[model samples]
Target: METFKKGTQRLTDNEVDQLMKRQPHLLKQSYDQIPNLTPNSQEVISRQATINVGTIGHVAHGKSTLVRSVSTINTVRFRQERVRNITIRLGYANAKIFKCPKCPEPQCYQSFSSEKESNAQCELCKEVMTLVRHISFVDCPGHDILMSTMLTGAAVMDCALLIVAANMPCPQPQTQEHLVALVITKLKYVIVIQNKVDIIFRDQQAALRNYEEITRFIKGTIAEDSPIIPVSAQLKYNIDCVLQQICNFFPIPDRQLQVPPKMIIIRSFDVNKPGEKPENLHGGVVGGSILQGILSVGDEVEIRPGRQSKNGNQTTWHPITTRVVSLYAEQNELVYAVPGGLIGVGLLIDPSLTRNDNLVGCVLGFPKQLPELYRELEINYYLMVSVVGAQQQDGKTQKIAKIQQDEMLKFNVLSNETPGRVIEVREDKIMRVALNNPVCTGLQEKVAFSRRLSNKFRLIGWGIITDGKTITL
Candidate 1:
């Protein structure tokens, strides 16, 4: 019997009832009755364990977009990245996955949202959910020229997500190289993301064919048994599936927290703004993940092979001693940093020294706890049969030439890259090489080997530092 004026139309009581039944969410409720979607208000509890997952693939594979969709933190920092739509450097983001109470599938999840309304509903089923796990994402640049950067990103990862564009043929140049890099890094858990699935929705046959090609290409590689997840990062379609797979495949590895703390400095910067007061200027910030043990504020740390200095014709490296003034995880200040996730350490050092990533490639630990610095390294070399990313006229990988004595090669360990000259090639594949620059590394640490192909240094294989007793200073 009731009649309500709705602009030009008058709706009856029965009509309004039916409309409200169809959309129950429109019905207003009391403040207490309304579901809370505020992620911050909720006690965001995460298991002490965390895992770092790296994204690797060919250029324009939508790695940054995928990362932004999942994590609360912004991975891309450079203006060049925003303008070019390509990740130029290693980026990082962190996300917490939650399980929905009403949804049976684990894929029905949502990233932590600041908005209370958005957090109130399951992203897929509109159900209430709670956070279950927290994970750190390492976004690696996919450009062919940034292969060394990708290798550095992979070195810090416990697992990897190899993204491939569905619109293009599988195993593109950088794609092949990235896969090989994963193998060399010995990353066991992998999930292949077939991105841009939205573009192929119009053509059923094309989508099916692309899937088959991708499946076949991965069969013979190290990721043969890994799952292929079809997703549309732009549309956010099947993103939940990606998260679900991450929860299933990427398990936290055992950590030896009782040992002396060791961390590889992947990124270092002077976080001071220009024209700031001298007293307000903060110290240098070093960002990276702890490999093992725990580091706390006020801990005295030594950076080995710190800054390069020239004494006559020889370059010498000396360790730098500094105190940890502050600790940060995902931009939030922390009292300490533990193994398993990425952290930023604020050092009480001169800001000018850490500007422009000068502290990158330095290893940090307690004083005298680090391994010896070496300029000469003996490596147990193993060369790949073919060079990935190099294509012949027939679309096959070109055969790699054997490494010769006295030939120069690029050696990558952690975040450091140095030119090495092969001094002696033994019959057993062990090579004695002299580094053009000094590196602070321990024995048995993995080193990626690269050779000059055409004009670029293409990744060839991997080796281990068997002997590095020769110190530079």
Candidate 2:
């Protein structure tokens, strides 16, 4: 409760208090102390963001711009990201949606930063605006090489915002790939943002044509019926409409708060600076979204497939067990964190172990309660008609061939990505894969498969884990 460190940003005791003072609901710093606490509990809602909205589309399509304009907080914090003018790693920002009861319809719905007072006042009626929804945007990289990074972000998404640049064609290469990815992950609720409308504002005919092209592009796809809203993220235009749709359409899913807590490690960091005293050196900080249950400070947690070492041709992974020292959602410290948005957990361990995302794709949960780790799996697989973004020699889409014996393919299950060789392809759509890097997964889990297209793996289809060879440690 005194201090916490995330990346290079450190908040002192008084500074932490100054940030937490706005949310009255976070009065107690204990998990059990909260009365009848749900994910929507006032204290939690006032302080924490519950919904995880993933912003995805082609590169330079304004995914980051849309998130920045709405959240007022830039997701691109990395120096490399700023220099490249694109998101390389997964970026995040939280915003609170407020609604004035007296104002008319969608006009009353507006989005503000997470730091905005929970009891926000409406600009129109001066009425106290109720906090309707608090959402966190998972700003995924849209670069072709960063497709794997985008899939990892898609794992925890409750819904998606598909950005389509009006200046570009309806379906760019990554746009199609990402849409198919949404289908592979079974993300059904989507909002299509036709961004860069300002570039086409002078031409009504061009705008209408672009809209029709978008409709045709999404036809027969998961986003066929998704509402397409024109917006200028650079100009901050029609942002309220996006907020209104999010509040109106996106339903709050039922969270598994009673189950044993499970969180997927997506980002990890060493927050210590050079020349810091040994006594003041802090442990690693793990950042991710909890899939189920609640996690609190002082809880002993285990990260599976944690540390890997190879010895004389035999490979083994050692699990790391550490006590939760602190829990954080952005700068706001919490007694306990619910299962949504990206949360950073401070662990009492050597920071070097978690440094530079060494723990990314690891699973964190109660000790000995997680699913088994698998080195080989038997999956019921299915391939799409053709690769979404690739063309063939005959001037048509490239159809995917059958998985060959001993072919190397990429698989993404949960937050982990591993390259696996086809060990056996049997009848009844059953295929066995020997993972290059073992992953911790359970029976009946869904995995997205990909192939090397021009030296980069492009998503082809998905499969279900029917059986697997588990590793006993």
- Best candidate (score: TM-score): 2
What's the TM-score of each model vs. the native? 0.86, 0.92
lDDT of candidate 1 over 221-306, digit per residue (tens): 88999999889998889988888888777776766665678998888889999999998989888888888766765578989788
Query: For candidate 1, what is the TM-score?
Result: 0.86
lDDT of each: 0.78, 0.87
The count of residue-pair clashes in candidate 2 stands at 0
Best by lDDT: 2
Give the Å error, residue 449, model 2.
Answer: 1.3
Evaluated against the true structure, the overall lDDT of model 1 is 0.78
Which residue pairs collide in model 2, if any?
A: none
For 189-227, candidate 2 gives per-residue lDDT tens digits of 999999999998999889899899999999999899899
- lDDT score of residue 274 within candidate 2: 90
- Point out where model 2 deviates above 4 Å: 1-30, 33-35
